[model samples]
Structures are given as C-alpha cells and as structure tokens.
Target chain A: MAGVAAEYFLEAIVIKPIRLRGKIKNGIAEVKALLPHPMETGARVDSEGALVPAHYIEEVVCQRNGEMVLRAEWGASVSKDPYFSFKLHNSTVGDKITISWTDNLGDTATGDITLA
Target chain B: MHRRALVKGLATLLSLGLLPLNLYARAVAAFTAEQAADVYRELFGSAAILPSDRIHIKAPEIAENGAVVPITVSTDLANTQSISVVIDENPNPLSGTFYLTEDSAPEFSLRVKMGRSSTIRALVRTADGVYMSGRQVKVTIGGCGG
Candidate 1:
C-alpha cells in the first residue's frame, strides 16, 4: 500500500489519469469517463497542517468523430476523482471519442477511445 | 484484503449495471427560493431566473458519499446558450458553468462536492436573452473537503 504522501504526489504529477469508455448502443453512443484528481478545494489542510492550494479541473471538452460533442466547466466543489457519463445521438460503432480536461493550476490531460 | 474487498464490491455494483440510473427520488430541502435567488444574483449579477420545466437534472436523492455526487442536466429547449450548476449551501455557491454553441447539445453530466445537504440548481440561458431554470436537487450528505 502506498502512503498518503505518495498518493498525493501521484495525483499532483500523474499524467493521463483519465479513462474514457465509449459504446454504441442502438444507434446512440454512450460515453463514460473516470477522472482521478485531488480536486483540492484549497480549503483542506495537509498533514503538515499547511493549506493545500486550490487545484481543480476547470474545463472539460469531448469530441466525437472529430466533431465537438460536449463542453463543461468545473470548480473546486467537484469531487476528487470524478465520473461522468452521457449519450450522443446519431453515433455508430468504430467512431472515435476524445476527452480532454484542463485544471485551474494549468495541468491538462487527454484520453481517446474508439466506440465498440 | 480490505482493498481487494472494496474493489470486488465496486465491480459487483458496476456489473449489476446500476451506476447509470442512480437517481431515485427528488429531495428538495437545502436552499429556499430566496437563498437560491440570492446566489443567482451573485453569480449573474441579476435575480431574473425564470422558472421553467424544460431543463432536467438527474441526481441521487440521498448521496451516500457526498464527496462525489453525480449530476446530469439536459434540455430540449431551442436556442439554449449556457448552463450553470450551483450548490446553494456551499461556502461558494457557484459550482460551474458551460458555454454552448449552436452545434452543441444542451446537456452534460459531472460530479460535485457538497459541503452539506444542499440544493443543486441549474441555470440555463437561451439565445433570446431569457434565462430558464430547472428544478433543484437536494443532497443529503455533507461532502465538504474542509
């Protein structure tokens, strides 16, 4: 098992902590995403009793088959390690789904998937 | 062993395929109309939220884990321009906002942290300069990171 400090470090510097899953069902595309983030509200204290600055994903964008499908804005209130799912109409199997997010601290991550 | 058990439990729950439809009942108790309106004023610089049923929100009635409450908002209304989600009882009431394009759908889903049982509100803006609002989702857990 990893210590809490290691876990925090992993969350801070880790790359591509996002997992995107896309599936076509009955002519509609279902997309599910799992994003691991501290989403630190900056209101919490660290083990050293120091305030952790606000670090959160501020924006998320999704593209389907090279076309923009969705966009989202987030804040510190979002949970650590968030999950989201939505449906896209007029999509089919073998199409591509791409997701990207940018945090407040200027960290960004991207993940892509092929619908099956 | 404990981590293994937890993983197994989550896998079982996921396999059951019930993660998508977690919303059970509607619980509206955290914020009053007045408070929610005040939050609206603070965010948009006005208190002109027109109540409309076109906007829809799907969320769990009782979030066992307040730290991560899943919420989905969608609407079929035409000319929708923007959407904003708010947690009325949080220290900062405004949660997030989405700017929409003509080609974009008027829907999205995300997770939010709730400091306590509070009302989740979605405010939508249309192209005609009219603001349409949806119903409030009541969260029963205090998921404050503080």
Candidate 2:
C-alpha cells in the first residue's frame, strides 16, 4: 500500500485572483484564489480501509514583480480547495502577479494573474 | 422507596462521570505539536519558522462558532513581502495563503473556517527569510465538540 501511495499525484489545482466588484480600481487590486486539495480530514478512511493521513496545503504566497505582498499559513479548519482574497497596493493593468503554494507532502502549485 | 433511591444514586454517578468526559473532550481539541509543524512547513516551504514580534495576528481569544472565524494578519517589517494565516487543528492544516508584492499593503483581513479549537498562526516572509507569531483560540459549540 505504501508503494502505491508514491504513484498518487495531485489531480488538479486552480488559482484565480478574486476581482473586486468584478473590476480593477485605482491601482488597488483585490484577488481571491482557490486550490483543489482533498484536505484529508485525518478522520476519514481510504479505499484500502486504511486511515488516510491528513494532507493539506499549508502555505501560500503572492508575488508582484518579485516582491511578496501577502503570505498565509493554514490548518485543517480550512475547507477543501481553500479560498482566500486579499489586496495589493498599486497594481496597474498588465502587471504580473503570481500566487504559489506548497502542500504537506512537499508538493507545490503556482498560478498567475495579469491585471486587466 | 428503595427503587427511587437507587435511581437517584445512579444519576449522581452518571453526572460525575460526564463532567470529566466533557473536560477531556475540550483538552483533545487543543492544538498539538505535529499539527503545528505540518502547518509551518506548508506555509514557509519548510519548518524554519523564527519567532518574531514584527508580525501581528488578530483573532478573538474565544470564538463562539468553530465554523466561521474571523482572522487578520498584519506586519511591520520593511520591504514586506507576504502574510499568511493558519489554524493548527483544522481538518486540512493550511487555511489560507496570501502573496504580496511591492504594491501590496502591509495588512490583510479574512474569515476562515475552523473545525476545532486550536492555535492560529500568522506567518510573514520577507525577501530574506520568514517570521511568525501565533495565538490560541477557544471555540465553543453546542457541547464543545470539535
């Protein structure tokens, strides 16, 4: 069973900035992101009848032009595909913003937004 | 008359047992070290969290609901880069992760869901390294069930 575990990989991950009012305003950017994770409750059992160990993304970071403006750490309380929204100070149209996260298994995912 | 007395005696014993059971349940909901390490690695890319007073985490000491809790993270470091919030005993471990750019404010606020009573950690990383702070919050439900 442990051998099979190595073959399992993340199914899919999605990241999108939550647009405030569905529009960009005054160089201030608001974005929300969601990542798809099983978030194994650590209280559930898998198909083989083994208790699935808790697995979840613990950290996320958003970067603009190589400078980080926001970072977060999470625990089991967060729902699966955890969703979050935050603000940036002077995001102009066409600027590149990157969001990245790492899970408990050392797996990492990333997404980007181009201000419109 | 004997039957009624026996029933009363049993009731008293049951209530006494229940008192300790309730306390035990609350203690179990508290955060553990394993959960804390897991959350730290998820947020900082490693378990290299250095305690710092620069980062500020705002959350109620006691939350009425374990489902939806309000939390806020702010920092006072220069060239501030990122801020993140984490609940130690949530079902998943990592609650929310935010990335910041030069144009980002040094502050952020959000509401998260928690499944149990646990410590909430706020982590901040600058271009150089990472810093963190935490607080324990008690969550109450119908019966203090995590």
Candidate 3:
C-alpha cells in the first residue's frame, strides 16, 4: 500500500453564488449553496504509503447584507460535496446573500448570490 | 517433499483464517466515542448538552441503508436561532447544522449520510440565551452490510 499523503490531490475550491429558479416565491428568498470539498477522514492511505490527514469543512455561515441569517457546523460525516439550502426572510430581488465556510485544514470558501 | 506440502497446507489455512479477521477488523473501525466527542465539541462547544423537550427530531428508527438518512428537526421555541443534527457513532459526529433567523420558521429538514448504525442528536438554540436539545435516534442497517 502506498503512503496516505500521496494518495490524493488536495485542492481548495469555491463556488460563486449561482442563481437558481424556484428559490423565491412571493417575498421569501430561498437560497441554495454547493461547496466543493474532499472531506477526507484522515484514515485512508494512498499508493505512496502515506497516511492522509483528515480535512473537512467545519463551519458554514450565511448572511444577508451583514446580518447573520444561518450558520452550520459539519464533520466528516458529510459527503464529498457539501450542499446547503436555506431561506431568507423579507428578501427582495436585489439583496445579496453571502455563504462562507471554513474547513478543518483552515481552508475557506465563499459564495454569493443575488436575490431575483 | 511430504513435510513441505503439509507446511504449505497449514500456511494456506492460516492465511484463510486471517482473511475473515481482517474483514471483521474493517467493519469494527466505523466509529469511535472519541471521534464523536470531538464532533460534539466542535459544534456545541462542549459535551455537557442538556436535553430539552422544546426540540423535536424526526427520524426513522431503522434505516434500510446506512448511506442516506432523512432527518427533520422542529422546535416550538420562538425566535429560534439554530438547529443542529449529530450522529454519535458516525466516523464524524456532526451531521448537519442549520442557522435560522426570525424571518424563517422554526422547522427545518435535510438529508445526511451515515456510515453505520449510530445515535443521532439534535440541538436547538433559541434567540434567547438558553440552549435546548432533543433525543437520540437509533439508525440501523437494512441491506447494505453497514
């Protein structure tokens, strides 16, 4: 068996808020976020005989124009790609929604979507 | 030559015996208590969580597959701030966490992945300073040897 460190490539990836239809009905603003992460559990080994360290996104926060709206804390139980959906109150068509997250490895990702 | 053949046969049996042992070892490596506590602290800041009836967590008693589990958390508290779901025996205890604002209602739902049979806990923090929690859900494997 290979070492864990050499088993896989670790990259920090972020998604800029992509607008999706059906998120808003009437006045409530619904937002969905998809973050790219490997969520490694630090248990697996690579072909290079290295032990892969556990790396996963630990915190997620969603804000509407500097106002804290939603927040989440996750662990390795989350899947490879983490997706979150939330609803914002009294949001109009021009409000900005910001979603940010920090991984266990200190990697951070942020995405923003404009309410329409 | 006969002695050598006997030794080889014994070696083969020993190897076969080791195979099942290895499989069992992997199965038991799914989750640990220390890992669960780590996840709990990361989410709640401490393991001394007080269980409250204000939060109601809905989940299937026995999950057919360990891969996908559907969980719903609802609270009667006004101005609920956040809701979190945790699996006590999963490799990673923290499953899903949701932060709710005054604009949103007090109920939220989501799907989480489970690596094996474990206890799921939901914690709810209201707009006030008090913290409340719900009960544990027992998840079981259906067909997937989870």
Candidate 4:
C-alpha cells in the first residue's frame, strides 16, 4: 500500500475530502480515486420540492511524475460521489501519481500517491 | 454569419470603450449539449464513429439503481488519444471524456446516472479514426430526475 494519503484544497472548502490509491505491477501503475461531490443534475427537487441547482465536477486532470497523463471533461450525468480509475504504462516503483478535479462551482481538490 | 455577428458585437463594445480583458471564456459546447452525436462532433470534431471490436465496455446488464451505474472502458487500439462514455437517453448524453497521452493506458472507469433504460456507448478516438462499442442497460429505477 503506497498510498501517501495526500489531500490538498484551497479556499472555498469542499465538504468532503478526496482519496487516492495507487500501485505499480508488471510495468503498469493502477490508480483509483474517489471524489466526494453532490453531483446534482439541476433536475431533482428537494424534499421541499424545489429544483436542486446543478453542481458537479467539470474537469479532472491526472499526472505521472509531474508529467500530464490524462485530462477528463465531465457533465452532470456522472453519478454522485464519483469514482474514477485509470492506469499508466511504463511505470516505476517510486512514480508519483497526482489527481485533481474542479467542479462547476469552481471548487477543486488535489491529491497525490507514490507508487510502490 | 454567427462569427461575423460576434465580431461585430466585439467591435461595437470596443468602440464604446467597454472592452475588458478576457471578457468571457469560451464555453465548452459539448458539456451542456443534449444530443449524443452533436456532443461528440462538438468535442472530438467527428460524429461519424465506426463500430469496432477493439473497444471493450464492462457494465451490468440490468442496473438496479440508475443513479450509479458502474462501468469500465478499455481498448487495445494503438495510438489511443481519448476515450469517452455516452448514455443515449440521458438529458445530456455525454457523460465524460478522458484524453490520454502515450504514458497513460487506454482504460477508464467511471459511474454514471441514467434516466431510464438506455444504451451505453464507449467511444475511442485514436490516431487512425474514431471507434465505438455499446451495451444495453436496463434500469429498474430512474435517477436523473433527482
């Protein structure tokens, strides 16, 4: 378990923290991340029957050893508490993997992991 | 015509001394688009996706809860540039698109919401061309309404 447990956030603090886990095997590094978000679609009404405003992750970027590996653009249809995973090739034991996401509300969370 | 109008509007603002630095950021047209093909065309610059067996989508045949249908997409296509997921019947059919580099593997997993039983598609944009594969998912309960 090479999970360094790195979580970073700026002002406009989000409610929950982001999680990242990673490991390298057979020249490949596998990474999994959980970004806690409401993921509101702007269509659902509250218990009071008022439409909930849309708030979801707009983009996510991943880096390997300070090099850009992946960048993703998302819409509101992604499920709540979004779970994402991806892999990297030609990986080494000490490779650092960084994941960050920005939401529609302009909130962001970044975390990193050192693969073992 | 639209570009000309936008230029004219900018000129009018400039003439009125109302020009501001970076007035408005270019909006991502595909992010809010409702149609799947249009979204694809807007984002990847192509909607004529050809069917391919290389793209593999792993998902449930029947999703008990439409709010969270888990899926994983992977492909062996060489020079893979990007992979994206599309739900045919969602209000906004495009769920997400992952742009990858040479260091990144051609595998992506994410959860998505479905308004109803719909076709889930995995599209691959490679150096050669755009390819796609899809699977049908039946939702017992709708989740997008919420």
Candidate 5:
C-alpha cells in the first residue's frame, strides 16, 4: 500500500482524580466540586520572568445516573483551583452523580457522588 | 497488508453513529474564542440576543483580588439549552459556557479571573430565543494575564 509504511503515532493519556462534595436539601440536590489544577493562563511569567505555558481545564461535564445534567466549556480565564456549584431538580437522594473534566493538554479526571 | 487491516478494523465498529455526540463536547475553538461577540455569533449566527428580565447574574460589586471572583448565574427561562459567561475585560472574554439537560436547573456558580474592571454578561439559550443580562464588577487588582 502507498501509505502502508507510514509511521504510526502513539497517543498518551494521563488520568487525574477529582474531589466531589454535595448534599441534597429541601428536595434540591446541590452539588459542588473543587478541582485542583494549576490553571495557568499561558501569558504569565515565572519567578525567573520566563513565560509560563498555558495549562487549564477546558471542559467540565456533570451527569446524574448516566444522564447528562450540566456540561461546561471553559477557558484559561478560570482561576487557579477551579471550583463550581450546580443544582439538580427532580433528582432524589441516592442518585449517582458524576463530574468529569478535561484540560487543554488532555489531562482528565472523574469524580463521583451519591446523594445523601 | 498491515495498513489495510488497520483501516478495516477501524471501520468495523457498529456504534459509529454515536460519534458526533462525543465530538460535540470537545469544541476547543469556542472555548478559545477571544471575543464575546464571536462566541455569540457562533451560537446565534447573526441573530440578536434580547435583553431579558429572566436572566440573573450575581457578582460582587468590587473584588479585592482579581485572581478569583465569585459569580453565580441563574435564569427563569424555560427549556434552557445553555448558559454562558463573558468577562469584558479579559483577554479571552468568553470565560465559559454551560449546556444543561432536563435534570438540572439553569443555574451555576463558578470562580473566574478578571484582568480589570469589566462587565460580566450572562446569557441563556432557550427554545424561545437567546436572552442575557449583565453586571458590573470592579477589580482593585488586575488578574495575571496570559
């Protein structure tokens, strides 16, 4: 084949961990999370005055029991140690909740919660 | 040939139809969009966003530090498909966008950075149309720019 001998490229993946916290109160399931990330803006200088590369979470996805609830597209403008809070209506206790995110550099993590 | 087998194996998946949904969530261009107007353009495509009382944006009137500013956005509009936030002074003003489903309310709380004093615009996309609201935030110190 013409392209049979073409070089193959391998992709590497990195998995991070996410911490989740939330509680259901008054029939509303309020969920929030703190994502520990550097959230570099790519425009900042290091202590040595060298430009720091941009590294930040680009997307956040939340779901309830395998169904999508909230999906977010984020940029580098998010502050360091990004955190978010969202509410779920029509959801009851013991429903499984999942939160996940992928960064600009492709680092990803998933966090899980069960309503209490 | 090895290449032929590789190509054939890749196409053998029967679940190809669900691929679009996976790709839709990874739109990097919209996240990197520099201007708020460009972001809205990509969503509405020349359609005007109406000023609405249904959308609400809550943010501190003055931020002591630009690194982290707390903001909350909620909307009363029904059937909201998405909610987005834009900071007028940031280099990439389109801070983020949220796509919601029936299980969740059209409200979220997040922290973002501000380069300077700016207007925080929150928009909601519903079946009826696009509606938005804006709140001013004064920054005593500018956030580090990228």
Candidate 6:
C-alpha cells in the first residue's frame, strides 16, 4: 500500500512525457518517438555550485502489435528530450505500436500509435 | 469494447513475457569508467575493444541544447551485432546500447541528454565477435547547468 501510493503519484505527475507517430509503407512501418526528460547526469552544479543528483531514463521499450520490438538501456549519456526512430517489417496498416520509458528515478511514461 | 480487448491483450502480452520487467525497475544512477568497462566486459566477453574507423558517429560539433543532442551511428561493417554509445564527460559514461538483428540496418539515430561538453564514442560489435569503434564527437554544451 505504501508503494502503491507513490506509484500513483508518480504516474499522476508525469515526469516522463512521450510523443509517438507511425506510418506504414511497403509492408513496413516507420515509427518515430519524442521523449522529453531532464536526463540529469548528477555532475552539474547549481547556481550555488551544488551537484545535482543523477536522473536519467534507464530503459525504453517499443512494442509492435503487442510484440516486443526493441528494448533500450539508457544511461546519463543520452541527451535530454531524446528522439528515436526505427522500422518494423511485416507490419500492417492498423498494427499498434507502443513506446514506454522508465527513468532511473523509477518514473515511467508511455505513448502509442496505430499505423496508418 | 475496443479498450477492453486492448487491455486484455496487454495482459496477455505481459503474461507471455513480451515486456521487459527491467524497464520498470530502477537503473543505476551513475556509471563510472570502471563500471562502463564492466558493462563492456559483460556484453562483449573477452572481445577486445579495438579502435576502428568503420563506425561513424554523426553529431553536431556544438550542441544548441545539452538536454537533447542529436546523434547518429552508422557503419559499413558486415555482420554487425550491436552498437553502444559512451559519453566521456558525463557522470555516467555509458549512454546507450543497441542490439541489431541481421535484418536491421547497421545504423541508428537518437537524442540524448548531456551534462556538458563531452566526447561521444560509438562502438560496434560484429558477428565475428570483433569490436570496432568510430571517432569521438566533440559536443559543446549550449544549455543545461554548463
């Protein structure tokens, strides 16, 4: 119950936001996703020269038609507000694609699109 | 009705293990050079990380926004298995690791958050267990705390 409350709050605040789009062409689907994040490396100093704590996306999962297409492990090296694109073959016009990301802080967000 | 079916389908997918549980788990907060080397060891086994010009890293010499720096890694190497990116100056050096299938092209593009000016390194592993890398990308931070 304790963990459940925090989980709900994290989802409610939406620290990770994603924008996803997909299109089908020649039996393949091209997907593009934009994710906004701080991706803090915990090395930078604040105005007072205090080191910021580490915060970055840890993993990104992409699913096509309910099947896992890609899983990415990301560290602090990825730039903030990351963008990604990939292709899926043998996909139809109406196949569903979902992209989800989890950060080091355990916050998560998801975006999905149906191929057109 | 459609929403119900989608929910059920997601449940099925979860049961089938189509989703990676690690995505929901917390990740390492920071990765030092030693830890980055360990990650390489775990992935490449005894494969030596050799420097090669085959892998190409395309990034701006100066990033307008440290929060979202665009990068591309492309290679002409055959039988490529995977590619990984590293940032030399970031608190955590290892940024991304991509596994490419035979059908997948040996190229990838993505945006990452950087803390400051840094060198971007792209490493590619071929199917023959040989590890090759591209040149460093000098990223000048225009934003962030830098």
Interface RMSD list for the candidates: 7.8, 12.2, 10.6, 6.0, 4.8, 5.5
The list of candidate 4 runs beyond 4 A from truth reads: A1-14, B1-27
RMSD of each: 12.7, 18.1, 15.3, 9.9, 6.9, 7.0
Clashing pairs in 5: A43-B146
State the lDDT at B140 in candidate 6: 55
Question: Order of all candidates by DockQ, from best down to worst?
Answer: 5, 4, 6, 1, 2, 3
Tell me the DockQ of each model, to 2 decimals: 0.24, 0.21, 0.18, 0.40, 0.48, 0.30
B72 Cα displacement, candidate 6 (Å): 1.1
Predicted structure with the largest DockQ when compared to the true one: 5
| Tens-digit lDDT string for candidate 1 (B50-77) | 7778888888887877788888988877
**TM match of model 2 to true structure:** 0.50
Which residue pairs collide in model 1, if any? none
Which residue ranges in model 6 land beyond 4 Å of their true spot?
A1-13, A48-50, B1-30, B34-39, B50-54, B64-67, B76-79, B101-104, B114-118, B142-146
What TM-score results for chain B when candidate 4 is compared with the true chain B?
Answer: 0.78
**Residue range A31-75, candidate 1, lDDT tens digits:** 889988778887776776566677788777878778776777677
lDDT by residue (tens digit), candidate 2, A1-116:
55233224333334343332212679788776666665554555556555656676666677776776666555555655565566777678877778777655555678877778
TM-score of chain B of 6: 0.68
lDDT of 5 by residue, A1-116 (tens): 23221221222223346778888877789998998887888788665556666778888888899987788888888888898999998878899999988776555778898998
Error of 3 at B114 (Å): 2.1
List native contact recovery per candidate, as a fraction of 1.
0.54, 0.54, 0.41, 0.93, 0.85, 0.50
Which segments of model 3 are wrong by more than 4 Å? A9-22, A45-50, B1-54, B58-67, B96-99, B127-146
Model 5 Cα lDDT, one tens digit per residue, B1-146: 45446445544542566333355545556566678787788767777799998888989999989999999999989999989898977888888888898878898899999999999999888988889899999999988653
Q: What are the Cα lDDT values of the candidates?
A: 0.71, 0.62, 0.61, 0.84, 0.81, 0.69
Model 4 per-residue lDDT tens digits across residues A11-78: 24346887998988899988999989889887877665566677789888898889888888888999
Looking at model 5 chain A, which ten-residue stretch has the lowest summed lDDT? A4-13
After best superposition, candidate 2 residue A82: deviation in angstroms? 1.1
Residue A109 CA displacement from its true place in model 2, Å: 5.3
